[model samples]
Target chain A: MVQIPNTPAPTKSPAPRPVPTSADVARLAGVSRATVSYVLNNTSAVRISEPTRRRVHEAAKELGYVPHAAARTLRAGHSRMVLMPTLPVPAGPLYSQFVHDFQGALSRLDYTVVQYGATGLRGDDAARAWAELRPVAVLVPSPGIGPEGVAVLKRSGARAVVTLSPVAVEGARALLLDHADVGQSAAAHLYARGRRRIGVVVPEEPGMEVFSAPRLAGAREAVHGTDATVTELSLAYTEESAAALAARWRGLGLDAVFAYNDEYAMLLMRALQDEGLRIPEDVAVIGADDLMLGRLLRPRLSTVRIALPSGRDLASLVDRAVRNPAAAPESQERFVATVVHRDSS
Target chain B: MVQIPNTPAPTKSPAPRPVPTSADVARLAGVSRATVSYVLNNTSAVRISEPTRRRVHEAAKELGYVPHAAARTLRAGHSRMVLMPTLPVPAGPLYSQFVHDFQGALSRLDYTVVQYGATGLRGDDAARAWAELRPVAVLVPSPGIGPEGVAVLKRSGARAVVTLSPVAVEGARALLLDHADVGQSAAAHLYARGRRRIGVVVPEEPGMEVFSAPRLAGAREAVHGTDATVTELSLAYTEESAAALAARWRGLGLDAVFAYNDEYAMLLMRALQDEGLRIPEDVAVIGADDLMLGRLLRPRLSTVRIALPSGRDLASLVDRAVRNPAAAPESQERFVATVVHRDSS
Candidate 1:
């Protein structure tokens, strides 16, 4: 054995420094940063030899190089993230359908959808908290939130602010889904079906002010151009309350009812039936949101189908607005609603 | 003008170096580091003078001593965040109720709820992604995920992994909610009402396996224990499908039908009535989830009401488990289901 003079050299450790960066891979492969980027992103614009690609791949494998998400975000400036504030209002199948559509649409547009839990947080506080995440857009369910909150969110780097409300906000693009139209349409359908006195079910929940107010307004609006009178009846979402409403239907002189949504409509209809009232012949009933249960009824519940704007369209608009913050604010898009005639009405 | 620093002995600035630190407050208010911390944290054990407290607060305000969240988190060693993966199932009113109750329960326990959008991710990929956030617990809706996924989540530092599934994983706690019970109850209700031939509405959506399968199974289980025979019908949630089903209701010879949930139930009922079929007389219809619409239907929809475990209990258990990770894993918690008999059935 030849004895060699001891020269201090670094030992090759089994465990290497875990985090390998793109720069390290580039250095090992002897490639330009742009070439590596192009290859990594699968950009067809750059032309690289197969051998070169192989070398780059081998170097990346040897070093365990992975791109940093933070670095990518920093470069992009804005995240591909959409912040949806959780509505405190109870979400039903109708709202759920809308949400599902919205999410699918946004995902197709390559926008990451995030639903922030905002049960307790009020307007500005919720906005401030949401702003911390720096989302590109925020879709509010247009119930409790207003323009001031939208302004705060816009200031926090949100480019597109859209809300579903009866009235459009100043800064935000509104998907103005008129709840009044739902009521008006239902009333009109019932009226056409020879329903004279229409009873409107009012939910007795604290946070239902936004939903109830617009519906009442719409009911009044529909009756404004007709001889049919709309009577607002407060009812808790309970069997007893529904039973009470049904029992008093004869005394109220109401021939038909325009319940807020299918849920309320179903409840009132049941109570009326239990009270020995023959639907359509004695008391015609119309509902909003055109739920499936309405169709399964004995004298199927007639309903106003409030058509929601296509989720794809809304999501596309948000994407475009987010990309170009300088774009002029767009007006609220109104969707057309039609009444679906059934046995009840 | 009271400048006595002609020799440049010392310099004084009104604003304390922009951002305030504990040392700056201690020096300004003439208090120890420990005293300042006690006052700032509002520790009742400490008996600091009111005057000193005021001075310290003034000093902090002058110096702009905003508490750093990251630094605070670092000191705490664990996050107060609870991660709930978004349910892939199309949401409804029943889900909304659960979410509202769950959030309320969690908030009372001082846990911040965060809903993660889990559309594109599943299994280990989802676990690794969620784990990167370092959440203390993860509550996932069952069916879309499996046991391997749960294990992955557990390995990722999630202490309490609770899923709403009958299938339990090795390490995680399962909160089994028997959806089959909902189906069984709804079917039994119809049977007791003297309905013989029962039709179960199965949604023909591609991705609703988690929901539809369980409901179908429940309906099957109920039929198994009864004289009534269960007939499975594939129904797409559309006007066309409902109409078609209504046209064929007489041919099927079904006296009663469980339309999965209230939405489908309402849809089917309307369609049946459209074809001149009377509910409860021609076919008694029952739905699950006891949605508000069920009550609002003319002959209110008879439904199965599923009672989820009280969120307060779950939150408390989660908090305790998180605090004591070494403690034995909690036993499975079960939810109860019952029938809400109304006019439709």
Candidate 2:
């Protein structure tokens, strides 16, 4: 048998190395500090010799000297940062795609996009946390920020405060994405298909209530005075949960179901199929968010296709808001929900 | 019909408002500026009356004065910010969950988490941009940072530079998450199950080469010195692409396939079924990343489940590195890939 050697003890801490500064770059380039600043910052107003500019840039690169963003902000009294608060739960594919697009668009406009994780804080506390960074703009999700939060951010020098909420928020630009319209469109389509006793699925995931509650209310509103009845179905995004729900399908006597979204719909549909139920013939089903995977199902899933303004369009709106902080805030209806007909319903 | 009025012309910019400062709080609290700073900043070395602290807090709240993060960093010579560079591509569910978990863990350690979107930048340019913010730590993805980039960041006062890469970086702590293991596990499992002719999928998505290329190579490595053969299949993440590939499957004469991931596997499986080819009988299919949707299919998917180091463990590693900047950089293997046998294989 081979014997292992003992591990060595940790060494003492090394002495600190001095950080490179602009002065070092200026000395290396044989130029004045003012000249180095003008060349590095690209101050077009003050013209400098091309050779001098090149020398300054080369020296800075060799020294690995970078301008401090905090110092620049202090001098300019503003930052080109657009702050976005990350949500507590993981975002689905659709929202993730939108965020990527938005970031790309903002980058094109010379804005640095920063996502701050403001978990365990809400409303005014969250806003105060964001204000500490002194971002030029703040984009928040619904129920995370209110009028008081908006006031706090603006007081800390934020030019624009925007919210993606169901209703318009006072003192902020509102990008209205009401979940009710999605449920209304899905339920109305089912009712038109002559399916009665419809059930609406509510996801049991935490942080989903902000969206699921509005959808449930909208479904109830669709069948308020009609002979068709709407029933609430609680489901989780898991195979076991879906199988348990499908096992009692016959007792519920429902003719159709509107799963929360395409993911939940796929889960429930598979479970129902395992329980020996026929699609459309025995129980019709529909879902929201027309994901690509929905079409892979044998009976292609019918869904509510939700449309929001393009990321480029929203970026342009934010730029306008930042430029004109004194102008009255605008609230636009941005949600367009429509039903896509398929074999599932 | 109601008459519509023309839109109003744009208004001129309004007068700028005066920003409140700590002086205003001091005046409101009827205390000196030094006392206000000690009370608000919670200076442990100084002793103050409880009633005085309450008065300072009430005054600050009324004035809506927030200490600037930039100013505090200038004074402290360091910050509690852990900067992460956001990837260009939209992250999948597994990665998104890991990010949320990591952020939560970092927040619990009293560190502020900020994700910077460094679009249109690479290598040293990206490092220079991040260094401008003076972050205490930076966590970057694979192929984004190199030895020179790490040196630049260290010179700019970054205490911890970590990278999630397949191989260990020269001067940074590396969290090794090799994609090759995922493909190797899947291919080895298929070979053990009597699969002879195998095809490995490579996604055509632009930013996916960093992951797909290694996986394809690993699959080839698995079939070396055996009677089995490996073929490469190029595919896009779309139904049309899958259908087109499936249309030509008969001429290829492949008996088994290792799809890039479960999402692509589902798409290909559906297309093959539409082409009248039965799963496991005509061709055995296996995928990497055991997603939940894989089990919902008619024939449960066989996959390579990848286990990564927990977020809490990574957070602790970062904290230790930050506290001991002079210590030697460490690299640890953080990926464990295993195959889950199911009906498809």
Candidate 3:
């Protein structure tokens, strides 16, 4: 074994107390180490007396003994960990809600959900980093994980490799949520409402290109072979950026706009209103994600409501994939986008 | 040795490809495993030739070899993981922004930030679950982590136990962000505006009680020894709930309301407006966490501007604690809340 130099001492306690082990718990409880393991790990396969279990639990509590997950993984050869690499951008309420539901569902399925912040890493580098943890499954919510990354993860003992991407990734189960549909639906709605000079708000925030690029492409596709002209308007999430965009709005001469999402749309709409632009009369506005705050606005913002797959369903899919890693990778297009018409358009 | 039965096979690969190890990379690169480890782990103490390093890296990439984090921890006796238990509730923009920034800062400091979903676990149980991962540090953003929990984490090799709570937790470094201050600032601002009957919005959402209860107490504290009376208004985040509350607003006979935060304020404000109740004229409204969308509202929402500690500053504190675990626990009151008077109030 290669000696690892400069390994920091694990415990920095002034009088470092030895970590209580199962053997200590067993000695305290007057039971065998196997009995302590069965009790502490809650091995349902073996039945231990209730009083004996209580004794083991009491001893563990008294000694502050908790099983090390890493040690357990090393021994068991697998862990019930579902690694979700955290995206770089701040998750909006819509995304947060989905994550919350997904986590709850995954928890119910007895999987420990872990969100690892792999900020600077991408593709194979990121996959390698995640593989080091030896997670049973990896649910990547971004587009950077290529086929090579999927292969690396599978080779490193990942039972399931799932990706929420615009297109199917080789050797991975795809939770295809095409963002382009959101832009298409919004653009079509505006065009149907007699809007010809169309502008699309592309958020200038870094790491938003994965979603915004596809949405922009969809908007261009919707306006193809039509008199409607599509213009790209770059706007940041800040109020100042919205104001600056609104200040030069008249020069762009766009009659309608499909802001990337509700948050950006709300920012731009308020700026345009401050600039004496009436809602649909001056410039029609539409956004995607259909956030609740959008409906609270004065014009009752029009939006393309995106329906994501139920968290429970996704959890079940993951569970099934984990049970049968050899099963053919499933590609399901569960994303549905429909225009929710309100007063704005 | 205690036998662990029912241990699942590590990999379910159809053709079961063996996981490439440092030894495999060394063999392929015609070098010692120590050389490969030094090059891969970037151990600066031992220098290897550039050509040898390139060969080792190329072999690692070709064989998809990744050093096991668990194995490394076993050898080093510690890890560079900072565990943050994921909160039960969906994070709002303000909280999400803070997490994003904190994760980025921690990443720059070479700490792997991991958000573990300990949904059903609480207090000591939650700490035990986190300690099982053997994280170097535990940053609890919410309450429920007690002295016992701190002890449990520290005993399991956590060098730093940091908490963002209203009060300092025993035996843990405190990032004191009192939620009550937010409510007090808003209530004081409204009371100063000559509004006597104050209504404090308490969100009905589960897991929000930790924040809402403290804020409610603070509002009541602000109104103490005065004619102003504080009433608890339980409201969910949904627009339907806001509309239902707004429908019976006149019956409550409240002169002003301190909505939970800017999101709740905006939601309730729109509902009240829809009910033909002019803001500030009929009932002055104030909220906390001065969100940007609050400024975009027609009445320009008056809010308690909450200034949280810089992510970099918090990261530095965590790093300091990790480096010097025996140092006295630090308690810093970095949360500052001040009311921003706007057109709404």
Candidate 4:
């Protein structure tokens, strides 16, 4: 029963340790834990000296210390979650890429972005489900939330309720992204290019109606005084549907088309080409949401480009809404979509 | 001082109520809050009658009482999150749809699926970030994680660590999805259809090497015993790359191609068509991942279909692993990808 005595018998290199904690930073800066927290979180109520704050910052950076999000949420009752409800629609590569960018920005702001599934939920039922998360902020996309739902969410202590839709929701701060602008820009571009007969593609998928209906209305508005006519063409993402549409392309007497988005436009365009219609020569085509695939197309797809606010800007808005709470709830830009002319048109 | 004599005189309808809690369920079920919690959560260590459990369920259903996730996490340390780290690869519609289904299934099992942004994180650092949430389980896809990362996660109380790849990581239960099988299947289909010269598309995008390299290797394996030649074609999603490939198409002299996936296939298809090459006549094309966009092409795309285990099955497996932590790890099916035939090849 001999104990291993603490003697300087051998010199061995120490194994790699973990990331630095707040305590480590505080110890290094010769400050208290409260001061470290105050400096790190920018707790304005705390009157820490300038030199002390600078020392804390330098220590934190040197030690590579970052605050743990969950622990912070637990201690403060102010959650770091920015929960984006999963939409019913199958997100294309473009939307996924945009979401990825948003996640990166939100993470930079020390918010943990959580994507929650809300496929068939609506009204207060959906609100109740989201409230279970106790998120600091919730960013909802179209098939925009109703007033009762917003009230429920607000009651549940969501500091920032934001909707990304065509119009602003009453109780939520919003970024307006009207599909009508997309249709108007595309249709107007085609009309300016002197294409009189226009077909507006409406995807037959169930969830698309929210986005497509307004687009159709906008397309109709674009051709109001002109000899141009806008006809709603229902199409699905199946081979049979595309073939049927391509089969009747010549008889429809359409010289140009605004195909809801790049995906649909690419589908319709490929079919038209197979049906022996030379793109932009026999029938001009335009799409919305300028995707990378659009460029690889034969005639090169002309698309309505949505100029979304940068991720940093959106993150800042969320932060402002949470921090201030009483700020005005509106977008600086009412519309973000524009026409990006390519070889197709 | 009268409050409308207990409100019996008025015939007005009542206002909507707030989100239901366990108290409402307890009152309805004629049980204590502890009994209701025990019955609803199936707190196995506590004894409760079947009739009591039924009553609790009925009461909860009637009131639409959902357990608050954060409160449950705080009380029991049984986290609801099945955290999937964001991979470097661009998730197309297929993966997004799959994830959406997974989320729905996991939610039905009272697990919240959270996607964490780990764009630049790796090893223990990434594990530490994920561990901060204290998720019950984590489903990791390829760029196989290290032992240190697994140990960090396990030490932080992750009950289950699952990897979706051909190669299993130590200390993690693995679901083997050998993407190479997809390539082999696609190439074999082309060879069986009498196409000798084959071009295998390898995406030039940074993160794509994880998928594309193995696929190319498998394609070569499919033609090992034959005179058939497999050519590796480097393609990017850009228009210029497609154009450049189209310009050099005449010199490659390939009769067939197995593109990495549907997105890349579609991009190349349009370019080949623009270059005046006839589909299946001058060149045959096939791609892995049966994306919906593929079907709309004139010569409907042939694809390698990777039949992933259903979300419910995956959820059950996760639950099983958590309940029986000492159980051996194994996949029911080793090869997930199957070849789905269509007109393009």
Best by lDDT: 3
Interface RMS for model 3: 1.5
| Clashing pairs in model 3, backbone N/Cα/C closer than 3 A | none
How would you class the docking of model 3? Answer: medium
Q: What is the DockQ of candidate 4?
A: 0.20
Residue A262's lDDT in candidate 1: 72
Give the per-residue lDDT digits (tens) of candidate 1, residues B196-263: 79888889876666666777787778768667798989999887988898887778899989898877
Output the number of the TM-score-best candidate: 2
lDDT of 1 by residue, A1-345 (tens): 865679665544333123455787789999988777777756788799989898888886565454433344435544666878767766767677777777778877767777777457787666656654557798877555667767666654578888777777778877887777777777777777776788888899777878787778778787786787989889887889989877877888988777777767767777777889988788887777777666666677788888787767777878877766666667665766788888887
DockQ of each: 0.16, 0.63, 0.59, 0.20
Show pairs that collide, candidate 2: none
Better of 1 and 2 by TM-score: 2
Interface C-alpha root-mean-square deviation, candidates in order:
7.9, 1.2, 1.5, 7.4
DockQ of candidate 2, scored on C-alphas against the true complex (2 decimals): 0.63
Reference-based lDDT, residue A199, model 3? 95
Better of 1 and 2 by DockQ: 2
Better of 3 and 4 by DockQ: 3
TM-score of 2: 0.95
